[model samples]
Target: MEGTIKKLGQTEIYRGSRVHLVTETIQFPNGKRAEWELIQHPGAAAVIPVDADGKIIMVRQYRNATDGWTLEIPAGCLDHPGEDPLECACRELEEETGHQAKKMDFLYKFYSSIGICDEIIHIYVARDLVKTEQSLDEDEFVTVEHHSLDALLEMCFQGVIMDNKTISALLAYRYKYKL
Candidate 1:
């Protein structure tokens, strides 16, 4: 089948360090046209750092959008265009959790918010980690937390972990490996 929607043009409304806002003019297959506002993102990578005892290292931080704290897997956007996702994951793991992974296994990648944003999140499981010093960004204030895989699975089920990427990665890891 042919592509369903054709993008006629896009106008930039705003641009920020992490995301940009734009209005896109699209023509539907039914010959109808509409303008849609969307946030464009550079994409990101997240890592689930698992220690030798099988505890996953997580990060807790306050989110401005949510106006509250969130527990999530260590994640960050690609430093520049064409940066490898695995590299980003490894860097983020060490920066957020002070653990460098000796074994990085990619789990999956998906569009976290396909409706209003074009952000793709790559997920990985990091193991055989070595202790290191955390190198958080100047603006980042993250606290490291560790928990068992089963505990995280329960948190996901109980809606305690609300971050989409964290939930997705946890569920995917749990079922993918039959944990």
Candidate 2:
């Protein structure tokens, strides 16, 4: 198990601000060899901001990859390498939603797309929100909205919420609070 796949070599395909693509040659357990293309990412943090009224703050933004607008929790990539995930969550919540959390609790961490990408997302539940000024990146255009937890759960089941991180965070929050 320890050496199930022996990495023979890897070639860098491309490196971008958020991801690094590479092709690797590996010898399988049965002595078969194959090449695999992998995407390396710096990871990210997402926050489910719940206000005192039990409504969750969400962001709607255009995603070029999907060619549509997506409803998701406030999230951002680990822009500063080696920065704390919780700090990133707080920053993203405020920057994207114009809200600051007085308390943030870690919910879960998972790979966004494990098949070919090595990007792990750390999710947190942010409570006791305070209104603040929103500060988004120059290229970012987002609309902040709030919905009840139950409504969001219904949206998840109805295919309204398509973002994986948003779905995961909402389900985790439901389980955590028995909602």
Candidate 3:
């Protein structure tokens, strides 16, 4: 069974330089129809940056949507229409954490919020870090934190870290690095 899109009634909530609002009407295979309000984002990139001693670099920031600050891996949205995900990940790691990775390995790609929006998040593991000045965006407010892979995994099990992308990244890191 497959659902088809019948009509899309998109109203521009805010025509900004980055994101836009779009709504659609989808007809399901069971003859059910529904409307989905989506914040059309150009996707994003998340980086699990590891330092020389193999500790992961993360960030703590306040998310307006969640109404509370959360601990998460370094991530940022695509700024250009055709920007490469890996490049975005590299940029975000540098901007948010003030570190650059000499080599970056791809981990996996997933959606941040699949129920309402279609934002694809690409995850990567960056190693061989070098410290530099953090270049944060004007609208972004964040602080960097470092954690061992073991401690991060513990946080995941303890429910202290509860973001999908972060969790996914951690799991991927575990399997990929054989941790």
Candidate 4:
């Protein structure tokens, strides 16, 4: 069974320069209806930059949503429309962590929340890092951190690292590389 979207009622619960509030009415196949509150976003890109020593260049940042500092991979949103995700990843990595990757590899894409919003996240891996100067976004507050592969994996198991995109990508990389 399937039903079409009869109507959507959304109000700006909160608005900011970057993101906005959204609430929509979704009608289901069985005449059931529900409301969804979503954060309107322009999608994002996460980069896992690896150093020559096989360590991952991560970041320690305060996430307002999480109410604390989180250890996460360098990531950023697409400010320019039609900009490539790989380019965004490379740029974010360099800007946030002061490292540029010689090789950028596309691993996979995922949705942060499929229930309400249409935000898609592209995950990429960057290797052969080169030291560079950070050029962080004006509104962004981030601190760079580098972690050994073993320590990073341990953090994942201990739930110390709380970024879902980073965790998923690291796991996938381990599985793919058979590490």
Model 4 clash count equals 0
lDDT of 2: 0.93
Clashing pairs in 2: none
lDDT of 3 at 17: 74
Candidates in order have lDDT scores of 0.92, 0.93, 0.87, 0.84
Question: Is 2 or 4 the stronger prediction by lDDT?
Answer: 2
Candidate scoring better on lDDT of 1 and 4? 1
TM-score of every model versus the real structure:
0.96, 0.95, 0.87, 0.86
lDDT string, candidate 1, 1-179, tens digits: 47699999999999999899999999998899999999999899999898999899999999998899999999999988789999999999999999898899999999989999998899999999999999999999999998998899788889888899999899899888898
Q: Model 3 TM-score?
A: 0.87
lDDT of 1: 0.92
Summarize candidate 2's per-residue lDDT along 68-152 as a digit string, tens digits. 9988999999986788999899999999999999999999999999999988999999999999999999999999999998899
Q: 53-151, model 4: which lDDT tens digit per residue? A: 888888888888999999998888887567788888888898999988888888899998887666688999899888999897786788887788778
Clashing pairs counted in every model: 0, 0, 0, 0
Candidate 2: segments with Cα more than 4 A from true spot: 1-3
Query: Which number leads on TM-score?
Result: 1
Deviating ranges (above 4 Å) for candidate 4? 1-12, 138-141
Instruction: Please say which candidate is ahead in lDDT: 3 or 4.
Output: 3
